[model samples]
Target chain A: MNFDIAIVIAIEMNIKVQNISKSYNKIKAVDAVTFEVNSGELFGLIGPDGAGKTTIFRILTTLLMPDEGNATVAEYDVVADYKAIRSSVGYMPGKFSLYQDLTVEENLEFFATIFGTTLAENYALIADIYIQLEPFKDRRAGALSGGMKQKLALCCALIHAPKVLFLDEPTTGVDPVSRKEFWQMLKRLQLKGITILVSTPYMDEASLCDRIALIQKGKILKIDAPQVITANYEKLIYDIQSKNTHGLIHDLKNYSSHYSVYAFGEFIHYIDKNVDFKPEDLQQYLEEKNHSDIIIKKAETTIEDVFMDL
Target chain B: MVFETLQVSIIIMNKEKIIQVEKLTKTFGNFTAVKGITFDVYKGEIFGFLGANGAGKTTAMKMLIGISNPTSGKAIVAGLDVATQSDLVKMNIGYMSQKFSLYDDLTVNENITFFGGIYGLSRKQIKEKSIQLVEELEMQNVANNLVGALPLGWKQKLSFSVALLHEPKIVFLDEPTGGVDPITRRQFWEMIYTQAHKGTTIFVTTHYMDEAEYCDRVSIMVDGVIEALDTPKNLKQQFKVNSMNDVFLKLARNIE
Candidate 1:
């Protein structure tokens, strides 16, 4: 923790996405959305699939040219200084596209070579992470486990030690365990002062970031600390689980004050009229409606709620 | 040490022996994806294989289904040695790949017929099975549409139904529900529950922690090795972790 990797102290700490907008024919992918990421912060672009998370990422990483607005990464123009931006950023795309036929070590070496450096030159940078993959160094990249492949992709991304690291849903389909371990690895990488910008479809992962931007329908719904955004939630949430839980949605939607209700795995998350709602009142109401064993407890709002609200 | 803990647990679970793997390993060239780790899958139970990406779940599954040959050791699935009775094993087994294993260009009926024929089912049996599957999935309206145009969640449900077309003794799913809505994931599991009740052995692999908890028993792998094998509840209780994710994190740290 004490040793900083170059330590990247900056004079101007800011990123401005001024009136950025993009569309494909009539479909607006990014609709004049704008948000700034600090120089040394772990930020998240949290949203559902097709919510333009990938479009925003590609534009920021200088992969796709934006249609309407301007973007500046590390104070350099994304369009004019694309080469400078490319050399200074590390990106692990949502999909793993490394050479599948090559061994784990070979993949790392190939990535290092592409970045114009030898593994020996930057061995120290990746040693802590790479050593774990040493046992499978001889294993083909395609044959490495999901967790191992994730680690290998990460090592290659960090070989050049880019100033800003962009991870697009790095934990998309990885197991919960591997997903948890991967976050821990990101925290360690952050300790080295690497600015991280990650996108994910899972709302649960949003809480782990320093700050998150909840985007939906190609728009920025909200951007704040996970707790702050949740605290700002205006609707009252309840956990409505009971017999015929799947049928609860249609019945509840028939209620006059119900804001929204969506199934979230084991239980259903519901929003209702917050003005005069209480456990007993709702209980009696459901009872009158012939609902039995309804478990209606007030729930704190989550990032998913914010997106749903939008 | 997570790997060590998993290894110890798997050893104990194998004492009674539902699935017996003796030195089962898979390798290509100098690369070993699954390094000679043996275990067993119990009857009338849900067995889960948890691993990091490319950790060899797919390779191991391919071998168990008799599609790929093992590099060393031996595996007996449904009391039949995978090496000797490849066709016999296929007759008694159902498989679904991570890619959904469905032809996008083909209609639902076409896809069903294609697989049924491959499994050597009679024409009458295929027709009956197709009707039941379509009714169960509630996808009768889209039966004539190209499967490729369907959403991810719909495709997953259809794929699961298609896998069970012949009602084999066991069904194997490899991330069958990836990139689908959570609501869809729940419904897919419901279908799995109904099949398990009919005395079908279910073998699945997934990255979702919550999904792992649904398994009757599970084996965790690290570096092509089985680190832990136990029920989700038992593993969580033994590890003293709040969730399956923590248990996995604690175990993976040791391997790393």
Candidate 2:
């Protein structure tokens, strides 16, 4: 029985949280939050800024303690086994924390040395990302561009071959192209059997994760696969367009049946309160308001829509 | 009096160029940050300055706002030369950024009053403006509350309103809607529209492609150069892409 229990523990390397809560100055930062991450799963915590995402991250990484409840990472207690947890997990904070004055190569070497490892030992694990930074190895980290700096940070995080990786808002200010490239890198890392927990404010990134937890105001609104969350959205949204976008938004909000209206890309995403909403009805209303070049069609629901509705 | 009226009419008829730049360039040491970028912003136009990370957007913006001197170029902002009359240029423009703009320890009313005084408004004018500003934003309840205690969305809105206290001709916003909730982000854009409708030239920068679509015209920078500048619609049609995100990807990735 003892041997069997040991085997189960070895294979069940996952994260588990139960009713964890934290407060600051009597204001609840995280309130009874509970979730779990299976081994090798890419889990995402999606929310806007100041939604208690960073506090939860600090708690899980053993940098801070929860006021109540308990949690475990890699089958080790976060409070009792903090030393072990600290060695096994890699955490990249939302702010840049690397040594800015050191050269890129020096920063990498320093991190590797602290973990009692050498760059040669883990070259294969970070080969794909390090190649991009090879040319800038001699330059100071502060001199590197924003995208390059992020790549360097990720490389340092993986130097020890950590079992789980924690990334907070990695693409917050990155442009669309760099954001896309960053997601691709995460996908490749996940294929190597590393469990990843990432957070982002950009709602579109939720679809890229295996599973996501939509959080706001220190509470989880929903948790499920990205497809399931969007598929379960019950509202019928319409893509609205016209020559004068500003005027179109005002007119839609004034319509009697309008439930919600906001700009989405080039079109205004409109949701009607009526169950039997008709496209022709909205079309006629817009025409009467002198909106020309009108185009209305069924719009696909996204994570942003779900978040706003919640 | 007749001559003054005729001059004002002529300015209005000519489209009233609030900002005009010609081959603006800036360099530091051996690196050229902004390389001979040229563009014009008319009165009441919401011009989006976009680029990938470290694509010279910040550097270009600094020069245009008169804080950083250009290596070589000509930029006339509010009828003052940026390089020669930087102090005068600063007085004629309002600047705001997501990272820093408002003090955390000051109350909402204090911030408005403080910024009003710095803009050279008289004591009587500041008093009247503060009262009107507080009511306009519907923050009567939190007027005396410290800005640190407010939510992120509310702080952002209040910061925007404070920037407009002096009613400068042009407002420079650096990622104003970043990290705010969806509803608040739209509400912020509505404020922008209202300001533009009142003839305030808005020069803004953002990473959100959807926000780029709302600009009257956009300029995409790559490798310290303006690769594309046109209306979002025309750029999409030219690139044969469906959205501005695709247009940005094609442009940024192609250069890489």
Candidate 3:
């Protein structure tokens, strides 16, 4: 309504949130969150379960109203213009919510018809994803594999030709190979100029997004490029390994100079309280404990590491 | 520390075999869910069963746990044959399913009592064990709260602990750390390490490539067959990849 704000909104910001908050019973599901997505930008909400990412998606897709603050999708108010927002946004919920008995093509047709559009009208938009589903077009949706089910859900969401796509945990249970392909499809969709807002529990997928919001406990911890966030981690980290993996962790914890220690896949990531701590000292310490096959080196920080530091 | 000492003693007593499978096969009509797979799980080893979705990992796990009968082949778990002695095999293995088996509506202490009762533990033994378990998991403060009220991380840990209430020879975890945070996952792995050190064999299946690296040895399944089986290091070297994720991607990409 203000002149300055109106001018900023005219720049074609696809999605914007201002001090949004939501609660259920006494639990604060989403608390005072705010962010913006430019046109065609791929934004990610990265967090673990109970982090309120799903609540924000529900609010943005106009499926649920925020108890406080405001959000707009494609310049349409989420609260005042719920009907318009619904048509302009595509949502693939965390759970696979398609009709179980319907065939793949029938489900696609049903979603398209509900949106008052024919699949042929917007066939090109979903063509890349549909080709994968084409092989099992006659099979029932419930019989599809996890990866295939996700592709079909994505196609159904895009059938309406929405300006923005909202996908919740789209790759949570999917395998690594399918996860890579799904991101590839999203990249192609981004080229077509559709703003994407995806939520995922995998920290590795954070790098695929143009920008990400690291959220936890219903709070936004940080929002920036994944590279920027990890680079900003304020710590001297190292990846420690030894023949006795369990013994290594136990010994590292007992070390005086160690600050924070965590198990990261095959190795352990150790942060020292002293900035100039020597890796040799820790190596010698482990050696004294009879730990063999030692390999210790400075390690790169990841999104999950930065999130944990916060 | 007690576990570490116990592990040393177990090694001195000679490493035992907890699970042995020879030419395992399962079929539904013409569809072979498990196609003549074979492997062995040693005592106190963390065995990671890595696979993509629809890779028949669950079908194979079901047979090993005595829940589903294999169409052919043999599996000896806890020194008992899984084919003819399935009922006895079930009694020797603890199972924590993909969906963490915790009664949400019940209180934490109540859930413990319930699971303990199912395992046929006496009231006195359940009382003593629950006290030690709660203390070890650092959940004494929330012992009386509803299981649903606890955070996801705590619930997962509790579910794991409850699965081991009977202290079976091996624990079968199906995607145990799915959807958990990195910090919590690290902690869960620590728990797995602790459990293994105490002479319990860990048979876990996971979609996480990073987790595969943590196991003593891993078997990668593709289309109901074990295409590769080795330590994480050898798998990477054989595939010429940097990470287990790449190794899995390379293997899964080969499947039509």
How large a fraction of the reference contact set does each model reproduce?
0.38, 0.81, 0.76
Q: What are the per-residue Cα lDDT tens digits for candidate 3 across A1-310? A: 6867655644654899999999999999999999998777999999998899999999998889999999888888999999988887899999999998999999999999999999999999999889888989998999887888999999999999988999999998888888999999999998877889999989999999999999999999999999999898888789999978888889999999888898887788899999779889988999999998899998999997888888
Q: Give the Å error, residue B104, model 3.
A: 0.9
Ranking of all predicted structures according to TM-score, beginning with the best and ending with the worst: 2, 3, 1
**Which of the numbered candidates is closest to the native, going by highest lDDT?**
2
Chain A TM-scores, all candidates?
Answer: 0.90, 0.96, 0.95
Question: Comparing to the true complex, what docking class would candidate 2 get?
Answer: medium
Q: What lDDT score goes with residue A268 in model 1?
A: 68
User: Cα lDDT for residue A208, model 1?
Assistant: 94
Show how many residue pairs clash in every candidate, following the order shown: 19, 0, 0
In the range A96-129, model 1's lDDT, one tens digit per residue, is: 9889999988888898888898889888777888
Off by over 4 Å in 2: A1-12, B1-14, B254-256
Please say which candidate is ahead in DockQ: 2 or 3: 2
Better of 1 and 3 by DockQ: 3
Q: Which candidate has the top score in DockQ? A: 2
Error of 2 at B8 (Å): 23
The segments of candidate 3 whose C-alpha lies over 4 angstroms from its true place after superposition are: A1-13, B1-14, B254-256
List of clashing residue pairs for candidate 3:
none
Q: Which ten residues in a row have the lowest lDDT in candidate 1 chain B?
A: B11-20
